[model samples]
Structure formats: C-alpha cells, structure tokens
Target: MRRFSQFTCIDWSGAKTERPNGIAVATINRDGPPKLISPEPRWSREDIRNWLFHAAKTEQDMLIGFDLSMSLPFHDIGCYFPQWEDSPSRAIDLWHLVDQSSNDDPHLNILSFLEHPQAARHFRHSRDHVGDLFTGGTGRLRVVEQYQRETGQANSASCFNLVGAAQVGKSSLTGMRMLHQLDGAIPIWPFDPIPETGPLIIEIYTTIAALAAGLPKGKSKIRDRVGLEAALQVLGAPSPGPLSQYDDHSTDALITAAWMKNASRDKRLWHPTKLTNEIAQKEGWTFGVF
Candidate 1:
C-alpha cells in the first residue's frame, strides 16, 4: 500500500459564487494535528485547482481528498447517459463533455448541462420535484451508491440529483472540471492508479470518514471542540481546539483529515472488493466506502 506523508480533506461547495464559510480545507501532516487551510475570504474552485497544481509542484507523497463525487454513476447503466448517442464513454471523456458544454457559464457552472435539452429529460430539475429525484426517489442506484448504503452510511445522493441541501450533483459537476484540468498533472483515485510520489486527489465523503472515526449516525459532522477532540483522539491525533459546530466546512474537513490520514493505512481501502477495471474507468468508487 502507498504511504502518505500528508493527508488533506476539502469540504467543497458548488454554489454559484465564492463561499467563504462554505468551502474549507484541512490537513494532517505525518507528525501533526489537523489544521485549516481555507481562508476567511473563501476560495473559488479555480483557487483550489491552482493550489493543487502548486502542491503537485512542491509536495511529496501527498493524498488530498475532495468532498465530491468524482464520476457520475454509469456502472448499472453501462453509460452515464443512456439513449444519448455519442455520450462520453469514459469518465475523463465525460469531464470533457461537461467542460465543452459549460464554457459559456462562468466558473464552469453545470446548470447549462442540467438545463440542456439532451440532459433535461432524464434528470428531474425542479425544487418541486425533489421527492422524485435521486436521493429519495425510486431511481436506480449506481454500484458504489448501493455500497455506500450497505456500509450503514446514509444513502448518498445520486450524482444526478442537482437540487436541495443534500444534493451533491453540482459539486460533482464543478469537481469534474477541476479533475479535467488536473489530468496528467495530478492522478485521481479509482480513475487512475496512485503514483509512488507527488500529490494525488481522491473522492471523499466526509461523513463516511466521520463514521470510521466512531461518530454516531445523524451526528457524524463534528461541529464543537469537544466533538472534534474526541474524533481526533480516536485517531491518535491532537486537537488545536476552538472548533465550531456551526462551521460545517472547517469541521468536516478537520475531522475527515484526521480520520482519513489514519485510515489510509488499511490495504482493504486501497483495493475494494468491487473495484474492477470497468468500474474504475466508468464509475469510480468513493475512497473510504470500501
């Protein structure tokens, strides 16, 4: 298994504009406590991309996880979008498709893709249609999404669900653009094999990392100093204290970084039972779900 000198978790946001409080990043060095890197002024997705490029140039043997779905669910369907001829066949190709279509929108907004006539039919887009959407609806789930539930974590919102607070579709879309830009620069998990050195990005569900750190369901997000301290102690790390329960961005990032840095050692996580070559290329698995 690959050993990392540093572990990082970014609590990402897909909001239209900059999210100062909503986007946060935390890191745990091989010998230290988790620390926040996100500034008070907030960070743009572009900012995060540039930072990763810098890290790729400077850091050695680093593992950075982003809190977003890296690939859309294509396994059960065999293709991300069925019946749509010339739809992207590979995950990387899918990123390019989104990038090409969303060029007119600033910051790579994927709403254009969502509202596009070709994509609108299958995807339920209205707030009024939330109940019929991916997270709670009768829609078919991807293989990894089924695995997410089998592990006792709350069922993850499908990458197709683009509305509501539970929706991860927007973030996933924005992240795909970043993944596209970082291609060949920073290898992404499941989609590509981890390199022996330099920085690598992985898909992360912070709540899953929280569960692995012994947090209870419905309360996995660490918001308070005590809760953060407890989670860190479980991982044999120390707390810098003064963590906020309300600041979900920093709290999720902090707790996730602590737990994931420790959890990365288990070889089972690196090679999941369901991680076949086809799945790796079409529907990459979440990093901690295995």
Candidate 2:
C-alpha cells in the first residue's frame, strides 16, 4: 500500500505576482513530520508552473492544498470586446490594493464586489469565458487556454480572503491606543499600525493548519496543539504588547522580540488566545474577543 503525499501552502496574496514571496509550501509524506518549503522569492511564474507540472507528472498520488485561489469566475463573459469603446477594463491593477489590511471592514472597497452581491449577480465564470470561443475578437482566449492546460488548474479569477480586511481593523485599534496614550500627542497618527501584520499571520496560520490537521476549529484545542506552536515558533511572532500606544514599530518590535525568544528555544510557540476557562486563570488575560 503506497502512501499518498499531502501538500499544504499558505499564500499571502492570491495574485500571481506576489505569490513567489508569500507562498509557504509543506509536504507530508506517509508517517514522519511534514517538510516545509520556504518561499523562493526569485522563482518566476514559469518556474513555479514548471515545478508543479513536473511534480504532477511524477507523483500520481500527490494531493496539493494550495492556499491560492484555484477556482475561476462562475460565469463566462460571452464575447470580450477589447476594442469596443463600451468594454469594461480587463486590465485591473490589483497591486495597489495589496497593502490594504483586512482587519478593517472591506465593504468600503470597490473590489468588495468579488465577495458581495454585485459579483454574485454580474461576475462571469472563468470557465465559461474559456470554454466558449471568445466572440469579441480578443486574443485573451489563447492566454486562458495556455494557462489552464499547462497548470492543470482552473481558469477562474482569484478572490481575497477576509483576513486581509481584518488587518485594517488591527491597525485601527493600534492607532486608537496610541491616541489615548499620547493625549493627542505630537506626532499624531505619525505611524499607521495597519501594516504590523505578524500577529495576523500567526492567527491565520494557526487556523488554517488546525483545519488541515483535522483539529477542532474553535479556540481551546487549537492553542494546545504542538504543531501549531511549532509553526509560530518558526514564524517567530512577538507577544501582544501593552495596550499603551498604537505604535506600528512597537507592535512589530514586540512580535520580533517574541520571535527572537522563540527562536532561541528548543520548543515552539503556541497560539496565544483560546476559548477555554484557562485563559481567565492566566495573568490578566481575556478571551473570546479580538
């Protein structure tokens, strides 16, 4: 009986361009611990494609769990009119939106349509777009076909997750704390803590890893898991500092310090929060919030 191979990846952005650096890949073969693959920042799209293609060809029993969006648009655009004056813009510059954190409410953004009612009603499935002969005389069909066939993946558009929005919320909290501590201090709003994302990363990785490991989705069991602790240790996340000021660098510094401590240890760092009563017993800690 041959064992199946399992691959797990965490992608920072679902977009192709940023994926090289943000992607984390881990493979679990039969019985031993999983092997994690660090992101190769220099790996080009072609390089990744070739790697996946070669792996798929060689490993008949491989099962990949990509953090990136694999599905395409639910409906196809019948005829893409690239030259038509009325045609909507197909070239979307999504990079600018990448830095926007997810901790905040996303209903404020135009791209919210991807996850909202408008997209549900008007979005064309990538499958439909590629399955049908593009009628509008656009050459994009070739690109679609080549991408699909070569990648052995779907042709659908990728969507961002809610975590991205939550980062904004975290930043907001950081800013508010700063104002309170500073009393309308000199460098008011001098730093936006929205980008202090190590905590968010830690939380997300914990959740997803638990999900993949068939662990319970709630707080208590997740925080106790050794594997989750190990990943965080690898990430070297800092402890949440005092709610004094909303300092971006301070928050980052706190996490960096924690990472350093964890880095020096033989053991890994566990998920910080929990749903159990144990949290109440812990020093000045509260749970079920944030």
Candidate 3:
C-alpha cells in the first residue's frame, strides 16, 4: 500500500450561502493528533476547492476524504437516469454536467441542477414533493452503500433523497461541482488513477470513521470533549487539546482525519473486495467502506 505523510477529512455542506456552518476541515501530519483548520469563521464550497488545490501543490503524499457521495447510484439502475439519453455514463462526465448546470449558482450551490427539468425528476426535494422518478423507500443506494448496509455499518443516506436531516443529496451535488473544478489539480480515487505522490481525494462516510473509533452504530456523532478525546485515543492519535466548540461537524472532521491517518495504511481498503472497474468509473467507492 502507498504511504501518506498527512491525512485530511472535510465534513462538507451544500447550503446555499456564502458560508455554511456545516463545513469543517481537519488534518493530521506525520506525527501528531488531528486538528481543525478554520482559516475563516465559516467556509464555503469554493473556499474548500481553493484550499484543496493549494494543499495538493504543497502537501506531500496526503489522503483527503470528503463526507459526501461522489456520484449517484448508476449500476443499481443500469444508468443514472434510466430514460434520459443525455445522462452521463461516467462519474467524471456526471461531475461536468453538474458543474455546467450549476455554474451560475453562487458559492458552488447546486440549486440549478436540482431544479433542472430532467435532473429534478430524480431527487426527492421534500417530504410532500417527492420526485415522480425517485424510486425506493429511501431512494437508490450505490453499490458501496449497499455493501455498507449488508455489513452492518451505519446506513448511509441515499444521494437521491434530499428530504430529512440525514439526506446527503445536496452535499453530494455540491461536492460533484468541486470535484469537477479540481479535475486536473488533484486526482480523485477510483474515478482517476491513484497518483504515486501528492494528495488523493476519496468519498468518506464519517460514521465509518466513528465506527472504527469504537463508537456503536447510529451513535457515531461525537459532540463533546470527553467523547472526542476517547475516540481520538482509540485511533492512537494524541489529544488535540481543548477545542472552541464540540459540534458534530467539527468532531466528525477531527475523528475522521485521525482515522484516515491510521486506516490509509491498510492495503485492503485501497482494493476493496467488491470494487470493480465499472463501479469505479460510474459510482466511486467510499474509502473506509471495505
């Protein structure tokens, strides 16, 4: 397995604002515990994209994980949009389509894409306004998400369900735009070949990191210093000292960064048992799923 000098976890948001409180970033270097990085009071999607581009140039052999689905379920239905001929066939193309459709939206928001005539039919916009084509009780799940479910990990919100608090559709859409913008600056895993050096981006489920920290399923969100310290210690990462706040977003980023630091060393994760060439191209795998 390839070694990493640093690990980063970004808890992303897709709110339509200049700065979203849900966004949080944390990183761990070669020899210490992970610490939150807040260059500003709040971060926007564009801010993260710029920061990642800079990190890709400066950081050495880093693994960066984002808590959002990189692409929607394609293999489950044989295509992203069953009847739409214009639907993209690959993850990269999907990113391009999302970015292009939402190019005018501020702060990399994906409102335009959500409201697009064709795309709008695939997502569950609200409890009473579920799209006609939004299939399944909780929307479609990617192959990796199905694996997570079968293995007893915390259930991941489908990328097509934009309704409840657990919904990841908005975050995933906004994240796709960022991925499209960072196309050549940094290579995203599975979608792009793993570069021998420099940073690589991967889809991450924070709950998976929380599970690795010994937290039971469904109780993965750590929101207190005591809980945060206990989880960090379990990952063999030292204490980051007192934090200004202990919200789930901040704690999730911190714990996942530490988890990534240790988990990246496991060779099996780089090559999951079920990840195949087609899945890699259409629906990217989450780093810690396997």
Candidate 4:
C-alpha cells in the first residue's frame, strides 16, 4: 500500500456559471489539518482544475478526491447506453465520448450533449422523458450504488437523474469531460491503475468520508469555528481557527480531505472485491465504499 504525502477533496458544483456557489476545495498534508482553499469566494470548475494541475507539478504523491459520480449505471444493461448506437461500451469510453461531444463547450459545460439528438438519448434528463437509457428508480441502482446501501450509507442518487439539488447527473457528465482532458496526467482509481508514486484522482462521496471520522449522520457539516475544530480534532486534524462564516460545501471538503488523509493508509480501499474488471471498465467504484 502506497501512502499519499498529501490529500485533497473537492466539493464540486454542476452550475453552468463562471463561478458557482457550491464549488469548494480543501487539502491537507500528512501531519496537518485540512485548509479551505476556496474560502474567499465561490470557485469555478476550471479554477479547481488549474489548482490541481499546479499541485500535481509541485506537490508530492497526492490523492485527490472529487465529490461526484465517476460513471453512470452500467450493470443493468451491460452498457451505460443500451439501445443507442455508437454508445460507449465502457466507462473510459464514456468519458471520451463526453469529451468528444462537448469539444466546443467552453469550461466543459455539458449542455451541448444534453440536447444532442443521439447523445441525449442515453440520459434521462427529466421525469417526463424516460427512455431505454437510465432512469432514476429505486430498482435500477448501479453496483457501486448498491455498495453504498450495503455499507449503511444513504443511497446515492442515480447519475441519470438531472433534477433537484441532490441530483448529480450534470456534475458527473461535466466531470467525465474533465476527466478525459486529464486522462494521461492523472490516474483515476479503479478506472485507471493507481501509480506506485504520483498524484492520482479518485471518486469520493463526502458523506462516506464524514461518517468514517465519527461525525454523526445528518449533522456532520459544522459551520461554527468550535464545532468545525472539534470535528477536525476527531479526525486527528489540527485546529482550524475562526470560521466566522462558512458553508456546508467548505465543511464537506475539509472533513473529507482530513478523512482521506487518514484513510489513505488502509490498503483494503484500493482493492475492493466489487471492483471487478468489468465494473472497473464500466461502473467505476467509489473510493472508501468497500
């Protein structure tokens, strides 16, 4: 098991704005508390990517986690898009397709593909337009999503659902496009082999990471300075002073980064039995789920 010298977590936003209210980033070294990197104001996805690229060049081996679904459900139909022609047969292929389709989209926005006649066929964009592609129902969960339930965590949203605040469909789509851009630069765990020593990216659910640090469910996002510092202390993180005004997004990223720093030493998270070759190629595994 290779130990990461640094850990980072991003609380991603799917908004199609230059700077979204939901975007936040946090990072921690091996012996320190996680610090909020986007504390001054809201961050954009592009800004986050540039920061990561810079960190990759300057930092030691780091494990970066994004709070978003890496891929859609493929276990049910053996493919993410079952009835669509030229549909991607694997998860990486889907990332490539997203990248290719949204080549003209600035900032990796996914609106271009969302309205495409052929590409949009695979996505259940709304409640009325349910097609052969993935639709959000309790029964059609991906294998990795099932793991979320088995682990006593809240069941994750289907990547196909494109509505509501909890919906991750748009985020996952844009994230795939960005992942394609970063293909050769960073290895995404399970989908790509983690290197012996280097910066790597992984899919993470902040809720799972928060639970691992003994923070009670539904009450983990602490905004007050005292509460935030106490939660960090539980994760063995140093005190984070003076949280005059903070939101859940920053709290989520900070806690997740701290938990990731601690959880990186667990070898079992790297090689899950659920991460079969097929799932690795299609439905990517969520880090720390297994």
Candidate 5:
C-alpha cells in the first residue's frame, strides 16, 4: 500500500455534467514529487463519493482536505438561494431535493442545488445578479445553525471559485507538506496546520508558514519568481473552480509573491488601518485597494 496514499484536489467549475474541464488531481507517496494525475477523464460524483466513503470507512485517521467551501457558522453558501428561506427543517427539505436529484445519475449528483450549474448559469446570464449568501441575508445563518444542530457536523462541503484559482500552487504546496511530514521535518497537527482558513482552506497555509520562517521578513518578500509565476498563471486562467492540485513549494512561492505585491510602492494603500478606514468611510476598497 502507498504510504502517503492519495491526496486528491479537485477544481469544480459547476459544469453541466459531473466531470469539469479544468479539474486536476495529485497523489503524493512517501518522499517524492507530487505526481499529477491526468486531468482528462475527469471524475464523476459517484467516483468521488465512493472514494470518500471508502476513505472514511477504511482510514480511521485519514486527512482528506477538499478545496471547496465548507459550511460553518462563519461561511454560508445557501445565501445564494434566498427562496430556500427555511433551513434546518427547511434546509433538510432542500437536501432532499439534492439527494433525490443525485439518485437519478450517480455521476451527475449535485451536493447542493443552490450551488447547481443551473443556478450558476442563471446568475452568470441574468442582468440582475441575485444577492449571494456571502452578501448576508436570506436567513442563511438560521438554516446553518439548524443544520449544525441536527447533523452535529458543522463542516458542510461546497465548491468555491478561489480554490480553483489557487489550485496550481495549492497542490504543489500540499505535496511539499506531505513530503516534510514523511521526512519528519514537521509534525502533522490534528488541527490541520495549513490555514488558508474559511470555506476553502488549502495547504497554502503550510507553505506560507514555511516561507515566512525561511525567508527574511521584509514586509513580505518574493522568495521565488518562477514558482510565483506558475501560481499566477494558474490563477489567471479562466477556470471553473478554485480547488486544484497545488504543490507546497510553489504554494509558498506564491505567498511570497503576494507579500512582494503588498510591499510594492503601488500597494502602499493595502497597509495601515487608517487608509482602510478612510477608504471604507469615503468610497470603498474598490477605488483604492487595486
């Protein structure tokens, strides 16, 4: 059996079918570069579900981190479906719809209808973009609260755009972390050392920590240009999802680049609470933070 087993990352673009186009997967074994799995022949929902169930069933302590938004008190995706109004009891009803739909074709299973392709298409096409859950409203908090009460599992998974954008670096960065673990360089914490945080937490956090510790802290310096470029190339691509197979080293490099951007003379406005307060009071980050 492979020591590291499978560390899979997916980029979900909300395609009509199950398999997305820009999807990528990477597997890391004991001490080796993250071998990229073929992007073609994308995986189906059934495949993913089966894999998840199998992993959960067999690996008592398996660490399966997905590059998607997970529902907790702070993050809510159902806000996109204002009509869903009811959560917990009402949310359960919506889950039934998703469950019912998922049964039709295991491959085309929709984990949540609110985040369905149809809804995404409607939003993308419609002139009046509906307010999303992140915008706050639609009683999403109440619904999520009820869900936590019933399931006792606060982490409800959903796809996110940022994960796909940061996939390249995330995948490589994760690979590096796994390698470090194998080499006994770092201890894998139960609380997950990687701290992208929020809905789409990726292993980039680990890479960032590594970079921060190794590189001189000159208000965020660029450690590696090549790695940063690769990361940007992936992020800049018009992809579907934010979760992708990113490597740990490259992930660290990208964080360094972001810091460099922060350190840039043009990016002065990004720092200092006064500028942010002034911007927030006067106009907004849209006018200046760019």
Candidate 6:
C-alpha cells in the first residue's frame, strides 16, 4: 500500500436544504492535530465535491474518508436489487445509476432518487410508507456491515432504511452522486486499486474511528474539546486546541481524520479477512472496519 501524506475525513450530510449544517470537513497531516476546514457556516454536497477535486490537484498524497456507505448490499442477495432487471452489478455502475436518477435534484440532494419509480422500490421512505420491494428486517446488510456486526463493532444502518435519525440512506445515496461526479479523479479504494500515487477515497464509519480511539461502544460521539482531546491522544495525535464549536459533526470529522492518520499504517486493513474481490467491487468495505 502507498503511504499517504495527509488524511481527511468528511462528515457528510444528505439534507434537502441548499447548505446543510450537518456537513463538516477536517484534515490532518504528518505532524499536526486535525483542523476543521470550513469556508462557510454550512456546506452543500457540491461544495465538498469541488473541494476534493481542488485538493486532489494541490495536496500531497491523501486518504480521504467519507462517512457514508459507498455501495449498497449486493452479495447477500446475489445482486443489489433482487429480481430487478435494471439493478446495477458493480459499485461504479450503482453510482452512475444514482447520479443519473437524481440529476434533476438541486444541491446534490437525492430526493429524485428516493422518488424514482424503479429505484424507490428499494428504499423505506417513511415510517408509514415502506416500498413494496423493500426487504424487511433492517433492510439488507452489505458484507462489510455483516462483518462489523459479527466483530461486535458499531452497527451500521441499512442503506435502504431512510426512516430514522440514525438512518444513513440519504447520505449514502447523496454520496454516490458525488462519487459519480468525481469520475475517478480520486480513485475510490477496493472499487479502484490503490494507485502508486495521489489521493484515495474510502467509505468510513465514524464510529469505527471512535472505537479505535478507545471510546467505548455506543459512546462514540465526542462533543467537547476535553473528550476530543482525549480521543486524539489515544490515537497518538496532538490536540487541535480550541475551536469555536464542539458539535458532534465537527468532533466526528476531527477525530476520524486523526484516526485515519494512524489506521492507514495498517496494511491488513487493505486486505480484510472477509473481503473478497467480488465484495470489493460490488459492496465496498469501510476503511477501519477490519
């Protein structure tokens, strides 16, 4: 595996608004604490995509982690969408399908995809409105997510469930749109082989970062400088000092950036015991889940 000079983690959002307050970006390099990079109070999904393109051009080798599922579950059921002729077979194709289906949505929102006649059949839109094709029981789990569950790590919500505060369907779908737009400028790991040079993107679950930083399960969220500094110290990273805000999103990005700086050193993460070539190309593994 190639060494990365810098590490960045994005706490992404899929809110329908033009600029969702949930978006947060943080980065760290070889010798400093992670710092938040905010050009505005809130960021639109397109803003993050543009930032990444510019960073890929200017920054040193970087490992960027987005807190969203890179691809939906495909292996468990033999395909992403069972019995659906239009279901995509690979992660890249899935991204294209999502992007194309939601092209008319502004601010990179995934409303159109959620409402897509064929695509909508797979997602749970609301508490009272479950799609006819929606598979029951927490929807479906990607192979990586199943591994996470078996290992007693944090539990990831199904990319098909969009009904709760903890659900990640919206974020994952929106992220796919951004990934498609990126068009391989920054290679996404597992889906794309690690290049000898340049930045790489990977699916990340912020909870995994928090767990690696020594936080107990179910208590991964850090909301203050004290807690944040403690987690950073556990990861061998110095404190970023004071910040104007200490919300969960900022802290999640900050700690995850620091965690990636250390986690990337483990080559075994690049080849998990459960990940197969097929799973890598279709389901996509989370960076720190191994």
After superposing candidate 6 on the true structure, give the runs of residues whose Cα lies further than 4 Å from its correct spot. Answer: none
TM-scores of all candidate predictions against the true structure = 0.92, 0.31, 0.97, 0.92, 0.38, 0.97
lDDT of each: 0.78, 0.27, 0.89, 0.79, 0.31, 0.89
lDDT-better candidate, 2 vs 4: 4
lDDT of 5 by residue, 21-63 (tens): 4334443332233333443466554455454444444543222
lDDT of 3 at 261: 88
Residue range 1-290, candidate 2, lDDT tens digits? 11233322322222324233423344443333444443445433334444554553454344333222211121234222323333322111111121132224331222332333322232332434321222322223222223433453222222211233222222212222222222211211111111221111111222333322343434312222343444334553322312333222222222222222222222212222322232211111100011
- Write one digit per residue (lDDT tens) for candidate 4, span 1-290: 78888888998887888788888888898886788775455677777777777766764588999999888787877766666677877888888888788788887788887877776666666668754554546425679898778777656887777767678888888888878877567778887777887788999998887777677877667666777777788888997666546788888888899999988888878887778988888888888877
**Candidate with more favorable, higher lDDT: 4 or 6:** 6
lDDT at 147 for candidate 6? 82
Candidate 2 TM-score, true structure as reference: 0.31
Which candidate, 2 or 5, has the higher lDDT?
5
In order of TM-score, best first, we have: 3, 6, 1, 4, 5, 2
lDDT of 1 at 231: 78
Clashes of 2: 24
What lDDT score goes with residue 286 in model 4? Answer: 88
RMSD of each: 2.3, 20.9, 1.1, 2.1, 14.8, 1.2
* lDDT for each residue of candidate 3 in 92-125, tens digit (9 for 90 to 100): 9999999999899989988988889888888889
> What lDDT tens digits, residue by residue, belong to model 6 across residues 127-219?
888989899889999988988888987699899999888999998999999999999889888888888887889989999899889899988
- Compute the lDDT of residue 231 as modeled in candidate 5: 43
lDDT score of residue 97 within candidate 2: 23
Model 4 TM-score on a 0 to 1 scale: 0.92
> How much is 8 displaced in model 2, in angstroms?
4.4
